[model samples]
Target chain A: MTLAAASHGFLSPTGVEIAFVLVGIATLGAALQTVTSRQLVHAALWLVVALGGVAVEYLLLTAEFIAWVQVLIYVGSVVVLLLFGLMLTKAPIGPSPDADSGNRWAALTVAGASAAALVWVVVDAFRATWIDLDGTVQGSAEVSGRSLFRFWVLPFEALSVLLLAALVGAIVLSRRGGDAKGAAETSAPAAGEERH
Target chain B: MHLAYPAVLAVLLFCTGLYGVLARRNAILVLMSVELMLNAVNLNLVAFDVWLRDALHGGQALTLFTIAVAAAEIGIGLAIVLLVYRNRGSSDIDRLRDLAERPAGPAGAAGSREAQPDTGAEATA
Candidate 1:
């Protein structure tokens, strides 16, 4: 479907666009801080903000289910997992001077160059494209569930298998690591009992 | 809304993740950045799925899959990192560069050998 570019000028900003731009700005800033923050925990906190902003964006795009999933999976669990990992790894509570690697400037330059090129290409390629969000609710839980089960069931099942493998792999990796041989040996019978 | 909005946002977020993966000293921080990059791609998928109005909603399905995969990736990645830290006594990526080809001869090799037992003993203790 060819949307009329002449009618939808860039100057004519709709309410959705304005909201999107504002939230997009906040999301981008939060993302910047997530990468650049000197304090490790602060970076994870900033990541929450960024991911939440993306969830908000999903809501704005009328993807209600995706938005909620984004929140539940990302904000609710992923960030918490990251925090636990940080603590388990004995991350410093205060700011650490060496949080950044030695190639910071090089990384910045590479990121900047790629961002510039990608932004230019995207803006240029999609200048005429418009998203018609006023029509059917494209991403309601009902719609998402129907499509996910109908057409994507195979992959969904495969994904469950993948997740299970990851689960077992993680357990064994941490359990049988050289550092915890005695613990793993003791836990073996317990694991076997649990399996039954 | 113009598709460019989400597209540009995804691009910037991906690049932010690129920098993080490149510049972070901590293993967990690198994983966080990887999540950022994956989230950015999900945003793009959602936006385009909405724009194209795909009948099967392939983009959204793929997004869900990507998110699940990312979760799995993080779990496995953290497990690996924790194992490394247990063995090496540090989670700093740069310091864990034992695979790097060093020009130094037996001195460096002997030094690494000497340090191994100490780290192993510390880990067991």
Candidate 2:
């Protein structure tokens, strides 16, 4: 059986419609909270719901590997790390005065335009294409892993290096400005001349 | 009607995420919103993957890469946000305006501006 049937076997179209609506509602609720929740941590929690809904939708569509990976990487690691950073930085964790301000209008304008553009592109491109639900195999982890290390190897390695550079940059930036021994030692000659 | 499901979900997810990215000041919350947007894209990819399972598994492979890149993004993004918060005592994107337009300024306002592209849809949220 295809992953689609595995997800919901023998369901009436109405049943699928009901499930879709329910999931949509849940997804929207979490998304709203992600934006509107005053607490930073609460926003992250809401993101979990939104991400989880996507995973479920993937499963329903027979893309099991993508679904599980979404759970693992996005829900498990990414959000947890975000929360970790939030705590480490000592963010207000509550209502912040700067959270919403005069820029709301500007932000809304930009966001709306981008969304409209994206939706337009997607809809326009696919307007004539019909969804073929023929039970063909797709989304196997083995196949995807091979492609990653094969044809896409260069971009993959580039991403790794980029991440490494970002890690080092973060460490350098986090150090106190005046305390770097390298900078202090280099400036010692100038200090001596000034004293003379 | 069936095709509309994925399209509608994509639009909603994208809009909600856009709102979060714009309205939420906390760096972590902004990251979560980005994840929402990525998830929206993933849905599109998988839908296409299923629809066109012949020749080249394009969508599934792209989703895999997207996941990897997202991981790296979170790692780097969190570290930078932490550093900024430590130095400035806040993660509010608005406050980061201090870095605006400074030549050779710390990975500055462009980052905030890049994260703020959803101004119009954000109001409906």
Candidate 3:
């Protein structure tokens, strides 16, 4: 019964596929806005929308655990971190000219070419492939947890260590300039004195 | 759902990120674009995992790992950008061309005229 529908060509669209397309369009639109907006802060805000749309796509794909994580980590924390970075850099409050670099046309050409090539290859490769969502849930939190602990325990532990290293590195990199400033303040002039 | 939908969506999103990375002047915006690219890959992973239904669920697990790594990357990236901003007074990539071969000097008009002949001499040689 289901096998016949699985073989149905492009004309037969399913409910989930329709929803996925809608959300995907919204997500791509937000992503475009994020990149092109002149207002710096607005770009960050648009990023939140794009990330949230990706989360919804995850939900449509039935990966419940990943969807929530995407919400919590990307839309929640990463966007906030980006906002903080923007403010710390003293980015302009409103639109200022020169938001894009001079090489954008070149970039556009390259990106467009790659996108064309990649989309052609991907669509040609997977034209008839259909994902069957009828069986037992694949991405429930319980299933992901069991698999993480059982088959993926080693890499999971290693990731924790990498997180720790990054935490310490961020702190050290952020705080590094203060001590060097005073020493450089004294030695810089001394070195100039020697040079002259 | 047909696999081509997610695959094509991911391709488009990745290209958008690639454009952002190339075209954006601000470091933070570039980081946002990188996040977009990574999320596109995550969507691909989740979609294929569901399709394959791996007994070990490698696709979904890798997605979790990717999310974590992305979080760490954003943290470290922001820190570095902040440090660069403090040192350079602006986070604009175009202005931070210390390593460029162009010899634009501090003394505006006279400097470039002097530099032009030297570069021209070098170029011809």
- Candidate 3, pairs of clashing residues: none
Clashes of each: 0, 12, 0
- lDDT score of residue B18 within candidate 2: 84
Judge candidate 1 at residue A48 and give its lDDT: 99
What tens digits encode model 2's per-residue C-alpha lDDT throughout A89-136? 776756766656566777778777877887787776655444445455
- Residue runs of model 2 more than 4 Å from their true location after superposition: A1-18, A93-98, A109-129, A146-154, A157-196, B101-125
* Candidate DockQ scores, in order: 0.56, 0.30, 0.46
Candidate 3 residue lDDT tens string, B1-125? 88889999999999999999999999999999999999999999999999888898999999999999999999999998986776556788887654465565687788766767665333222
1 versus 3: better lDDT goes to = 1
Model 3, C-alpha of A58: deviation from truth (Å): 0.7
Q: Kindly state the fnat score of candidate 3.
A: 0.84
User: What lDDT does model 3 reach?
Assistant: 0.88
Per-model C-alpha RMSD: 5.1, 9.7, 6.5
Question: TM-score of candidate 2's chain B against its reference?
Answer: 0.76
Candidate 1 lDDT by residue in tens digits, A1-196:
3545666878989999999999999999999999999899999999999999999999999988989988999999889999989988889999999999999999999999999999999999998898988899999999999999999999999999999999998998877524456565364434322322
Which of the numbered candidates is closest to the native, going by highest TM-score? Answer: 1
CAPRI quality band, candidate 3: acceptable
